[model samples]
Target: MRKFQDYRDSVHFYGRIWTAAAILMLLLAPAAICVRYNAWPAASAVLKGLLGVAPIFWTTGIIEVLTYAPMLGTGGTYLGFVTGNLSALKVPCALNAMSGAKVEADSEEGEVVSTIAIATSSIVTTVIIAIGVLLLNRLTPVLENPVLDPAFDNILPALFGALGVVYIAKNPKIAAAPMLFMAALFLLVPGLSGAVGVLVPVGALIAIGVSRVLYKKGVI
Candidate 1:
């Protein structure tokens, strides 16, 4: 217990430092661009844009913390936050790595594995993105081919579909509730597609609540 606790503390300490540095580095790029080009927007314009988007970002950030932190734990969660794209990439990568290794997420090995997986994913994603950017000119014709559009459109669905199948197989009753509701919601209110980030957490909350009820009633 003492050793794990100490490890947890150290993870938190360094996680926070990296998270802060990531934020600073992210902002520095834009700040440097504005300085170099003398292209700073007016304060009012910046505030206007923030007003339009900040609430959505703030809400998603809070929801993600509440939803993702528990599953991801301290180190993976911090790394995910720094790297960004948790819902689409890092969370899946970390969870899949842990599952593949047959490690309980709360175990010492699981924590280390999850963090390493998240970091490795971030590195891989960065490399892929760099390569894409470098070869973008050469790849543009092939990438923009009309035949490939449908495949590109389905990429996200394909990734999540595989995950959904595993989850439904594990516990059909618990998964069914959120899955059905989410399917109906998007079908009925197509506008909510733009709010998928907010809605994903909402669906997770529904699943959690349904599972709790099922557990209490011995349904699971």
Candidate 2:
């Protein structure tokens, strides 16, 4: 218990430090650019721009936190959020690691596993990005090849599809409702594809509701 508490405290301490640093670094780049160009926008203009999109971002961020935090745990959540790209990369990686390790995400073992997974992922990603930058000229044609465009576009779907197959197989009953609903919704509306992040929590809630009904009926 003492060790677990210490771990939690340490995670919170460093997580806050890194999160603050990331925010400061993000602000600094724009500030430096503004100072260099002497092109500071009026406060009202900034507010106007933010007004159009800030709410959507805030909604998505909040939804993502609620939806992903349970599976990510504290340390993993902090690292994943700071690193960004949670939906596409960090979330799937951490979840897969926990699943592979057979650890419940709410447990101490899961926290440790998640942190290691996310940290490893962050390091590997940075290394790859650095290498990619160095070889970008050489890789550009291959990366931009029309033949690979479809593969690039479906990367996220493929990642989730693989993970979903594993989890859905474990709980087909619980997965059925959300899977059917989402499949139909996407097949019909299609344009909501851009809003998958927001829809994730909605699907989770629908699954929860369906599970509750099934449980009450002693179906599963």
List runs of model 2 lying over 4 Å from the truth: 1-3
lDDT of 2 by residue, 117-220 (tens): 99999999999989999999999898899999999999988998899999999999999999999999999999998788899998999999999999999998
lDDT of each: 0.88, 0.92
* Superposed model 1: Cα runs more than 4 Å off: none
As a whole number from 0 to 100, the lDDT of residue 157 in candidate 2 is 80
Q: Residue pairs in steric clash, candidate 1?
A: none
For model 2, give the 10-residue run with minimal summed lDDT. 1-10
lDDT of 1: 0.88
